[model samples]
Target chain A: MQYDFEEILETIKMTEIEHFDIRTVTLGISLRDCVDRNIEVTKQKIYDKILKYGKNHVKYASQIERQYGIKIANKRVSITPASIPFDSFKLDEFVEVARVLDKAAAEIGIDYLAGYSALVQKGMTNGERELIKSIPIALSETQRVCSSINVASTKAGINMDAVLMMSDVIKETAERTKDKDSIGCAKLVVFCNVPEDNPFVAGAFHGVSEPEVVLNVGISGPGVVLDAIKSAGKIDLQQLAEVIKKTVFKITRAGELIGREVASKHGIPFGIVDISLAPTPAPGDSIGDILKAMGVEDVGAPGTTAALAMLNDSVKKAGLMASSSVGGMSGAFIPVSEDQAMIDAVERGNLSLEKLEAMTSVCSVGLDMIAIPGDTPSTTIAGIIADECAIGIINDKTTSARLIPAYGKKLGDYIDYGGLLGKAPIMDVRNLSSNNFVGRGGRIPAPVRSLTN
Target chain B: MFISYFGKLKGKKVKLSESEIRAIAMQAINELGDNANPELVKEVVEKAIKNSEYVPIPETQSQTTGRVILTSFGLNHPGIVSNVTKVLSDANCDITDLSQKLMGDFYTMIIMLDISNSPKDLSEIQNDLNVVAEKMKIKVYLQHEDLFRFMHRV
Candidate 1:
């Protein structure tokens, strides 16, 4: 007997009681080499590389999951940002590349393929402008392809121009996929301080600096932490934080072990283990529930921010201790549609869009999975991205938005996507216009904090 | 017949229930790992009566928590249950309930474990058991009780 019985049981308890799982095992490949002047050659090269890696990664990930009895929610792929490698392509030509990525992803038998992306924190290059412009068509035309754009960062100021443009792109994407609850918007994330090695999509991409190929993991277990908090029974905040910190260590250790094993078996270098408290729509598997367990009466209440900050910092501390290669957005994710508690709170009118924005300042992301009225001004959407990106830049944290403008749907209407993506109610937005704020189409200078370097 | 777990080199042997004898022996082997000295192990096994965990409690399981069924098959040898339970217990899995069979040279075991209080994780325990199973030439598999019910239910 190498291990005690109790340790084995705790792991089982997490999955059984709380619906704990490895959210994603994304294998990132540098598509930089897939670049070619000829579009056909480029598309073929990308397809071949993706198919080759996809087969092995998925096979090995499923094997690991079966062998260890840990459920993996998704096996995904992230490639080098398309804007860089296919920089010479026309605006519409980039859509063909996206089609190739989508087909390759499906052929590889993966859930999603990310990196239909661009980095325009400071400015957009000619190819990046083409990529950004092609985003709507690419997203609307491809089922498994996810798109992301980094419009702000700590070192780079927020690109209000890109922010404004994405608002329109998102609008078109929503309209194009209106039949499926504007699902195209669901696959697009506007990011500030995006991670290169993120295993989670709609925001995953192999950054310019990543290796030729690597494996990254995203570990999620909000239910396990909530159970511990419940067992602690009205403990003080300090004690609750301590409890979260300890539990996170076990989860992160499990994640690192799984990630390293998969990487070792596939002969790909291990990237990072992102131990985030990402919630699904499942009952009892909610961070909002954890907030309640921590004595916050409502998820979006006054104390919610403090509770989230504690949870986020505690996870990071535990993850840092558990794995030296911790990266990506490793904190509590407050995606509205994906979390049942959040959806309930919003539908019940207790969680307002304003409160959600405030909460996102402390979370790993900003205003994620939120659905707004179809007629809400794209300027307002731009304003939201700008504000969220400003928070990321000034506070030096990762923040993103995956907002859906439910076409022809307004406040109080609900749309369900079933399973993991879950359901979201159309949230009301401030009626007043932010056209002037968004009109200032220039870099919102890097914050003073950026001068630390 | 239960082994005398409290018997030393020069002391009157004290009888221990079957569960007590098994718990202490497993505990010693679990701690010593592969470096365990046979004579020292026997001596510690006899002196393990002082351990509170060695004191058997009435079979009671909390109704709120469910269990997992752990199965192992191997060439028949001594201490199959002892060795398996030792590793599981050391991993903090509670051996609340168990059943075993030895037919010919093949041994089979099924253990009901409540993992709610485990200090380590399931994957780590699996890896450890895998190492031990390979060394002892056994095949081990685990499934949640609900999964077993769904699979075999009419």
Candidate 2:
């Protein structure tokens, strides 16, 4: 029992990586207890919960990072869906609750406030309907309140009716405020049984099972893994795993250092770290490189999905072993505009919405950062989003739609999101109509198995 | 004022930049000793950057956030602290904080901070760090604070 822990610290200090650091240590706090008989009381409860929980999180996360010599990328909070508590309340109450949540998030130095959401995928709860009704106004008025509605699911099959409602909702939300569309896009999302622990926004919300002030970290290193695969060519799957495992292990360590330090600094209990292959439209860091390293000529080639499945699994396997706690939709993302490889693939006719959808089956989420014809009908757009949601709900993973209807683009035309979002070519979808199917408004009922078991 | 070359490889035609052709020429002269042509080198670099990332992964990862965590066993071994810190110090991972404690047979440590000029992955560096840990007979783990929080939670 000769302990030399400080010596280990010296070793880590010797060879630090460059600017790479943990992006976010989000605290997912369930606010179910905040429900109340009076609207004013409920608002206060929401405010109090966020202020107290958020205040301690950043401080704690910072403390841990300081000890381990890592950086915490961001501090944010996600709460229970607003639909549950504001279900019976009026639009004014919804607005009031949103204001309080925004103020709390700001006070605690939290950058993102998620969970100002409603779910209307299968059937509209009275609360769900009201939340949806207020989305356009809430997003226009509130500073930090982001909202999402579960528009469709695969469990009970696609809710075409919900899709139609959501279609109008998006259109109206977009049109309601000219200057706030970015905020609109930032605030609103359409999901399919989205994960409860997602650290990314405009969809993060406290799930029923999450504890108050529980922290979750998101790790990104497509650049590192891509480079490793590049150097280790034509190797066996095991060899590939070895290279990736080594890379992921190191990246996860950096993330863990940040998370633990932040937790200690804030004095709250440390939570799980998520190892997601997050990508941006930056020049060189794309998950597409993994596919390229696997010998794909272009990212969306025929074998793309299979390649992604292997990459995603390999990443998870290595990440899960590195740390005891792992949460969030920890998978490789295929956001077309957010990855340079994907953007090039789209531009060069090697990628498409259909191809992206096919790839999503083996990955997480669908049609992210995809641009479509602006004239694309609301029903058709909803149908597309619904199809993506169906994939998530049936599979029981988080799925989201971030389709951007480029203001004046047509199929084959290109729109640039400038920075991080990159640029994308508009993709085509089937011209057939789903208007009739989407017109019906009612729950399709939960999947049969969920009810029985 | 520079010459450009066009070539076909893998059934795709590419227009090579003049500078690219020169680099190719330079490399060819070094390795192939004039046997390598300017056109060939341009193709190689263009293909290399396109088929793979030009920047190393660890270098790219280092750009976002540099958060860390430190765990220490105890203070029994008087010279242990200096020895433990050498590894991270050598790798350029900035020591943000140091948490050390002494248990019966093991001294525990947890450190948190951003790594400055760290290689692509922390785990890759761990083996090197482990060499120091092994010499001291102590177990060591390196992690990003974000990732560390994720791994430890129930």
Candidate 3:
């Protein structure tokens, strides 16, 4: 039979797809081995561990990137919770470790450093309690160190008892560092069965079960999927979904290939693939395209709920179908500055923190890259993070918040974090409000409803 | 035939719109099959009508439906249609079943899909699959008869 081969070719050509590559492969290294009776020996061991393990990480990551045609964006390290070594009176050990990690990160070309953290759930351990008391002085001395204090968990239920104490700890930490610009307060998170292989920070403490040397891949592909979905116009909803599924499959294949090769070359086991839609203030690839595709003119409008639900569903379905092993908060992100569309939405008065919270309900990570007023109280910021984490705990999904309270910046003002933090316009907060409820520092007890299950 | 409606012949001329003329042609065509030729075509024409505003109704007739054949190589790297059709021909499976999707090293193909009359179960047809798979070092999985239909609902 005679046939139109060209028309058939055109149909196959319609499947246009691309990927943004995995942005970061963070290795969570515990610094417990760095402790010693002698102060200088402790500092040297910290330096030695970072220098030894981090030496070949970036080199091997680059080689894998070239072989698989996938870009490996950042190769960094997050150590064991730094609060353990801070049980001293002077806080000297904390500053020493921070300086060592900063130097090691610079030498290895890793952009981010994390794991300056404290855990105070159900009540702080003696070491943890002391570390929490000295957060302000230690944070001020470190150049690149970022920290977090876990004050609650779903498994252990609400630690309202501990959270109440944490309120004062957070307040004192926030106040003591008022004069220092670099020392920012990001010390609040809720861990709901935290993963050992999670590479994203500032909550990336080396979990107990994880290996000393394992390759954790953080895959980012929002731009590629958004582009394909945008091109599939006038199609039925089911057909649109199929196109997205195919796109995600192809992108994930690229990530898996790269991850396996990275693991092989480094002689480290291949970790999980985090199929998250991480953004970087770039044009065309922003999460806003997804919202717009869902028929929302502005991202944070009343229709935002339906819009985000559709976006997250498609992303999760496509990612799951694409790869066998998927981990991390593998969903579409709505960070304000990291995404260009989100940044523009906030500046244009089309997006607000409340609307963002509504959108984050459907996203993997909650309230990420949000910039609130500098004068915003630590309790209020903690409350925002708490609300976001509560959604994660209840839903049994991974969620986190990374809010930047730009010092000396008020409502309508903007701060440029220059590179990866991008730049964000200060968003308005609810006025005439006191977080007196939050200030009554103690963990909110986990819901009694969960006990039945 | 100068037939006209009795009340409509009030002035100098009477005219039918293009649609009305086409309607007459269509009626003649339907009544006489393909034999309605030049004379029927001429009778359908009328003089220009006022405004001549008319919406033409589309012809309603049954036409042949198009078919898509999904063909797969299953196990080996065969030259598209030639080798895939050869397998069907050998099995006497006819051209009814076909879809080809190359996932990784595995060459999978499904044929439009009427295999009910075949003398073999799907497993029997998949026996010679080893020969192709060993040649390519890839396993071939088959979805025969009602399997594809049962699988993809959307």
Candidate with the larger lDDT of 1 and 2: 1
Q: Residues A61-170, candidate 1: write the lDDT tens digits.
A: 87677645678888999999999999989987899999999889888788789999999998988999999999888988899999999999999889899999999999
RMSD of each: 18.1, 25.6, 29.2
TM-score of chain B of each: 0.54, 0.48, 0.37
Task: Tell me the TM-score of each prediction against the true structure.
Answer: 0.77, 0.68, 0.67
Each prediction's interface RMSD?
A: 14.5, 11.1, 18.7
Candidate 2 segments whose C-alpha is farther than 4 A from its true place: A1-19, A36-41, A56-67, A152-157, A177-183, A393-396, A408-425, A440-453, B1-154
lDDT for each of the candidates?
A: 0.83, 0.68, 0.61
Model 2 docking grade: incorrect
Give per-residue CA lDDT, model 2, range A271-314, as digits (tens): 77778887766545788867988878998798888888888888
lDDT, residue A337, model 2: 70
| Candidate 1 TM-score to native | 0.77
Question: How would the candidate models be sorted by DockQ, starting from the highest?
Answer: 2, 1, 3
RMSD of 1: 18.1
lDDT of 1 at A406: 93
Q: Evaluate model 2: give its TM-score.
A: 0.68
Per-residue lDDT, model 1, residue B31, is 78
